[model samples]
Target: MSPAATRTDRLPYSHSSRETKDADDHAACLSNWQQRYDQLSAGSFSGVFEEFCFGNVQLFREGLNQSVHQSGIAWPGSRTFAVPVAIEGTGWFGGEVYDAHSMLTLGGSDELDFRTPRRLEILACTADARALCDYAQQVDHRNIEAELAARSIAPASPEQVTALGKLLATMMASLRATPALLHHAQMRKAMEQALFATLLDTLASATTASASPASCRTRQLVVAQARAYMEAHIDEPITVADLCIELGVSRRTLQYSFQDVLNLNPVKFLRAIRLNAVRRALKSADANGRETVADIAARWGFWHLSHFAAEYKAMFDELPSETLKRRI
Candidate 1:
C-alpha cells in the first residue's frame, strides 16, 4: 500500500506539518529526498515535522521520540544545514558525535548518516545551492564554495546555535499562529532574508578542529566496512568470527570498533538492523498476502519463531502478526 499522506495546508509559499507513528512514514514526510529510518530504541515511534518555504529557501523543525538510525540522500542540488536544538542522549551525524553546538552541512546530493537519540529536536535549513552561494558572495563578501564542497560538521558557538534555533522556532510559532502572514509579500521576504543571514553568520563563526586520531579513524572505517558486509549478507547466517576474518581484525578489535562507532555490539546491532528490515518487509507486503510473519522472519535469518516474536514485540511494542495485518 502507498504510504499515509502528510497533512499539508496551502499557503502563499508552502507550509506543512506532519506527525507520524511509523518511522518510515516520518522519513517520507520530508519533501524531495530519499530517506529510510530504522527504529533503534524500544516502544512505539513518534515523529513531528514542521516546514516552511519561500522562494528557494526552506526552514523546518523535526523531532523524533525514539532513537533512530536515519540514512538517506538529502534534496539534490540544495545545501542543507541542521542544528540540534535538543537531544536526550548522545547523537551522531556523519560519524561524528553532535550536540547543540554542532552544525551539520550537506551540499549537492550528499549522503546523510545520522543516529539520533530519543526526544531529539533539530532545526534545519535548505536552500538552492547556487542562490545560497551567490547570496554569500554578495552579502557576506566571502566565497563559501570550498567550504560547501567540504561539507564538514563544523563547530559553531553555542550562543549562535541557540540564537538560530530560537529564530526558527519563533518563526514557526508565528506562522502557525498567523498563517495569513505568508500572504504578506514583505513579511515573507523579510523572514527569508533573516533566515539566510542568520544561517550564513552561524557558518561564518564556526571553527575547524584537529583531525581525529588515526586509530579512531581506522576503527570507524572497520565499522563502516563491517556494516556494509552485514547488509550485503543479511539473509545469510554470519557470525562475529566471519566478520573478524573478513576484516582481518582480532575479535577484540571488531568488538571495540562497533562499540566505539555505534555504541552497540556487533551482534546486537546486526540483529536490530535485520529486525527493522523484517518489519519494513511486513509493512510493505502485497495485498495478495503470500507471506506470513514466520516466512518473513526466516527470510531475514530469524529461524526461531518464538524468540523472534518476543524480540520483535519488545522492540516495536507490537506483535509481528499485528504488523502484517495492517499491511495494505
Candidate 2:
C-alpha cells in the first residue's frame, strides 16, 4: 500500500472506503478526476499496466496490505481495474482514470512505481493480480491509444490528444440506452466478442491507410455459385428458381440472408454489381465521356429502357439519362 495524498496538491483524491457504497455517483467521480488532473500532468506513465479498478470495484483494497503517499497534485490511493469481463459505461470518461489497457491480462505480476500527480502507482484493485491460468488469454486493443502516447499525442499537438480523448470519452455514451449490459455475465461475454470484432475492423482500417475498394470477385463470391449459372446462359429463361438449384437454398432463404448480410439480393443484387463494373469502365475510359448511357447499359446486360431507368435510379439516385448528360 502507498500513502494518501498530502494537503498541498490540488488534485482532490478523497479517502473513501469500499463499504461506503456511495462512491459510484457520477458527479463525485468526475470531480475527483478533475482534482487528480489538476495535480498530475500528462507524460508520466511507464509500465505494463497490470490491472485496474474504480470506486467500489476494489473488493480487497485492504487485503493487498497497501500503503500509498498521496500527491498534493495527484489523487491519493491507486485505483486498479480488475479482470473485467465487461464494464459497460460507468467506468471511463474524458478527464477521469480511463484504464483501457488495464483490462488486458499480463503473465507476470507488476510492481508499479509512481511520482506524484503526473506519475501514478498503477491503480490497485481486486483484479490487479492476474492468475497464471488467466494470462494465456489474448485480447483486442481498444481503438484508443493513450492520448499521451509519444506517437500521436504531445503538448505541442495537445488538440490531437484532446480530440482522441473526446472520441474515447464519447464511446458507449449511447450504450446506457440499453440495460446494464456491462455487468451482465453473459452479455459481457457477447460484448467481449463484439468488442473484439470491432477492434479487428479498426486495426485493419488503421493499418490499411485507405478505404479499400470492395473487390469484385470477393463481392461476387456472395453470389458466385448462383452467378456462374446465371451467366452460363444469359438468353435462357433462367429465373430465381434456377438460381436456387445451383446455390442449394430456397429462394426466400437466399434472399433474406443475402439482403440481411450484404444489403443486396440474388437477382437485382447481381445485376447492380455487374453493372457497376461497366459504369466504372465508362467513367474512367481513355476516351472519357464518349459512351452513351444506353451503350453502357446494354454492355452490362440492361435491355429494357424503363426497367433500366428504374433500377438505375433506385441504386444510384440519379436517372441513367442524367448520368449520360454528365458523361457527355
Candidate 3:
C-alpha cells in the first residue's frame, strides 16, 4: 500500500477491503463482481479486493484462495484486461491457465470460468469494448479484435506481464493514497486514458508464435487427443500442462493449435464441455428427485452455484434451477 491519500487527491470512486476470512466477508468484498458463492461453506477461504472506478473504466485488484467461475446471459458491458499480479496455485482465466508469463484479454460480452486450487492474485481493468476498439483505431487504424481475437487469452512475454503488473500496483497505490488528485475530472480522465493506453500497449506486445503447416497438423492431432482426454477426465481437475504432457507436445504448440483451428482456448473448451455435460445430467435426471443444483454442479466440478447457474442460463437460455425445477 502507498502513503495515505492527501487532501489534494480527488478520485470519484474508491473502495477496498482489508482481507476476507469468511464467506460473508468474501461475498461482501466482491459485491461489484455480480457473483454469488458460498465461500464460507467451502472452507479454506481468504481473499481481498480493491476498486477504483473513474471516467469510463473500472479498475480492481483481487485475490482469493478459491476457484471462481461465472456465467450470465450477457457479458459485462466493457472490455476486460486481466494480468496475474502473483499466483501460487493453478487457475484458469481468459481461457488460459494463469502462468507466470501470460495475460488475458476479454471483450465486453465474454463469459469466463476462472478456477484455481490455491492462491490467485490478479489486477484487472474494464472499459467499454466499443470505446476501446475506437481508441485502438484512433491510435493505429487497425482492427484490434482481428489480430488479437475478441477474447484472446494467449501467452504473453514474461517481461511485459511483469511490467504491467508493476504499473497496476503503482496505480492502485496512487488511487488509495492520492484521493484528492482524482477528484479533478480532467486529471481523472487523463489518468484513465493513460492507463488504458498502457494496457493496450502491453496487449499488443504479446507474442504468440506462428505455427508451420506440419506443426498445424500436429496441433490438430493434439487438439483431438486433448479433447478426448478432457472427456475422459471431465469429473476431475485438469490443467494445460497435463494436456501438453499427454500429447507429448510443448505448451506453445497446443495453444496455437486450439487458437488456429477452434478459435477457442483449450481451457475454455474444456469448461464448455463440462458445462454441457452438467446440463445433460440435470435434464436427464428425474426433476422430482432430491438432487439439488449444487449437488449436480459439484458432481461436474462446479462448486459455485451462482456462477454455475448464471453460466448454465447463458448457454441454454434457462437457469440450472429452472432445469432442475421442471418435470419431464
Candidate 4:
C-alpha cells in the first residue's frame, strides 16, 4: 500500500488524525515507526491514531478496540516513552506485565513487543535520543543514556505517571485546538521544552527492582525458543507434542512455560499466530490472481475449509473470503 500523504496545511509541524478498521492499516497510521499489529480477540477491529510532530519531539495517542499484539521498532534516532491512560485489562511489554503506574521505554532500533487488551488507550512521547540525553544532563545533572538503553519498563509513582499523562494530553489538545501555534517558532520551542521537563521529572521518580530469578529467565527462554520455532515453520503443521520433542522439554514443562510467560496455553498461542499469518497473506494476495481462501488457509496448516472459515470469522469478525475480497 502507498503511504498516506502528510497534511501540508499544518505547516512547519505535522498533525494527523486517522481511523482504521483493519489492524494492519492502524499499525501504519503512526509515522516513522515500523509496526505490525495482529488482532488477538474476537471482534471487529477499530482504532484511532493522532500524532503531532515538531522539531525533534513527537507526541501521539492511540486507541484500539480489540486485543492486539504489536511488534516493531520506533524511529531510528529517537527514544519513546509511553504510558497507558486507560486500559480494560492488563498489558505486557517485553514479556513483563505493566499497569497504569508503569512507563514503557524503548530506544531507537530496539525491538518492541507489546500485548495490549481491548479498549486500550495510550499516550506516547518520542524525542531525539541525543536531545533527550542533553536535556537530562543540563536540567537534572543526570545521564539517562544508559538507563534508556537498559530499561524496557519502569515503575513510577501514581502521581508521577498521572502528571505526565495530563501534560501530554494538554500538549496534544493545545496543538489540535490551535494548529497555527505550531508555526510560531517560540511557541514550538516552549512546548518542546515543557514536554522534556515533565517527562524527565517523571523518570526521575521511577524506582527499579531486582532482576528476575534464574528459573523465571529459563522459562522466558523456553517461550522465546517456542515462538522462534513456530515463526520459522509457520506454514507447516505443528503440535504441542512436536514442540516438546523439538525443544527437549516435557509436556507439562512446556505448558507451564507458555502459561507463565504469556498467560496462554500452547494450543491457543499457536492457533492465534497461525491465524494472523493467514490474514496477512489474504490481505496481500493479488486481487486478480487465481489464489483462493482455501489455498491460503491450507498453506497456514488449516486443512478444513469450513472450520477455518468459522474460526477466521470468529476471531476477525469477517470471513476469509470477505477479507480477501476487500484487499487494498
Clashing pairs in 4: none
Single out the weakest 10-residue window by summed lDDT for candidate 2: 127-136
Ranking by lDDT: 4, 1, 3, 2
Give each model a TM-score: 0.58, 0.24, 0.53, 0.60
Q: lDDT scores for all predictions?
A: 0.73, 0.34, 0.62, 0.77
User: Residue 315 deviation, candidate 3, in Å?
Assistant: 58
Judging by lDDT, tell me the better candidate of 1 and 2.
1
Report the lDDT tens digits of candidate 3 across residue range 1-328. 0111211345355555568766456555532344444432255777887777655666778878766553321235566677877777555664666665667776655665555546678887766666666665554333566666655474357887888788777777765754545555544554555565566557653342342333667778888888899878776545554565567665456667898889998757766886887777777877567876666665554533455678888889998878766737
- Per-residue lDDT tens digits of candidate 2, residues 50-73? 211221222111111111222111
Model 4 C-alpha RMSD to native: 22.5
Best by TM-score: 4
Best candidate (score: lDDT) = 4
Q: What is the lDDT of residue 236 in candidate 2?
A: 40
The C-alpha stretches of model 1 lying farther than 4 A from their native spots are 1-11, 205-328
